[model samples]
Target chain A: MRGYTSDKDGYLTRLRRIEGQIRGPQRMVENDEYCIDVLTQIAAATKALQSVSLGLMDEHLKHCVAEAIAVGGDTADAKVREASEAIARLVRS
Target chain B: MRGYTSDKDGYLTRLRRIEGQIRGPQRMVENDEYCIDVLTQIAAATKALQSVSLGLMDEHLKHCVAEAIAVGGDTADAKVREASEAIARLVRS
Candidate 1:
């Protein structure tokens, strides 16, 4: 099964929550809620999103990267570079 | 259907390529490939990973976020905040 399949329930739940969280800001804008409050909510949503991304990245490294390495040869090196670049991008993001 | 479902094939192909890319760095380490070359490969992988993230984020905002806002009420503001925070985290990362 795909890594995603294993985490489907959790991922969907998080996404649903995120969906709700996103609505918060839109409503705030519609109602003209306090700027700080809206901004704070935005920040929270961002963190939540980052958490999701981090989780996925971790899984990718452990599964896909590890699998590639096990296969050996040029593929191993390719996997390592792929994982490293992914990490770099995550850090940059 | 989930957004991921629609992109399943593309995602898997990208992941497979990334898996190969990651191996490149590992082989470089084992074989003592040039540090510069390894680092360059790593950078490429990072960009590729970022591209994936950006695509996903875009989909999230368009589908889940938009759907939540359409429902209206407190949920709308919540979603807005969630999305903003996610973006902020991505930027920070």
Candidate 2:
């Protein structure tokens, strides 16, 4: 089971909100809104997405990584490595 | 007219795609997907949003901001200030 399984509903709610947020900029563009205004909406959506990422990362470390480390073996090392790479990708993105 | 007027279609298309991209994560969460996989999708959507912001910023600088600066007055200063703040928000987010 996934680390976020416990909070699946919460994550789904946030993601759905973000999906709606993205459409805000689309409507602004269709109406020829000012560039800065459209940009502001986009920035808001981007921040929302980032918040979700951070939340998921926290959950992953707390659950998945924690469980793997408890096992203490090659699996643990691979999990740590995989998580670090995922984090790097999150930071760069 | 907005700076992105020329590329309105492009911007709309990109925004629409991003809207769809956000749904990928929502579905993943609903299906109890791994935290890392869900995060990867979220990161992709965030990157796509950032790309759209950069494109809009480029257009703003080239057109709305440029035209305002050409006029050389208080409006120009305000426009520049607004654009700078927007850029700062983008960077922080």
What shift in Å separates residue A64 of candidate 1 from its native position after superposition?
0.9
Candidate 2 local lDDT, A1-93, one digit each (tens): 898888889989999999999999999999999999999999999998999999999999999999999998999999999999999999998
What DockQ does each candidate score versus the true complex, computed on alpha carbons? 0.04, 0.92
Give the lowest summed-lDDT range of ten residues in model 1 chain B: B29-38
Tens-digit lDDT string for candidate 2 (B6-73): 98999999999999999999988988888999998898999999999999999999999999999989
Taking chain A of candidate 2, what TM-score results? 0.97
Which is the leading candidate under TM-score? 2
On the 0 to 100 scale, the lDDT of residue A54 in model 1 is 68
Off by over 4 Å in 1: B1-93
Top model by lDDT, which number?
Answer: 2
Residue B38, candidate 2: Cα error in Å is: 0.7
- Sliding window of 10 residues with minimal summed lDDT for model 2 chain A: A1-10
* lDDT, candidate 1, at A29: 44
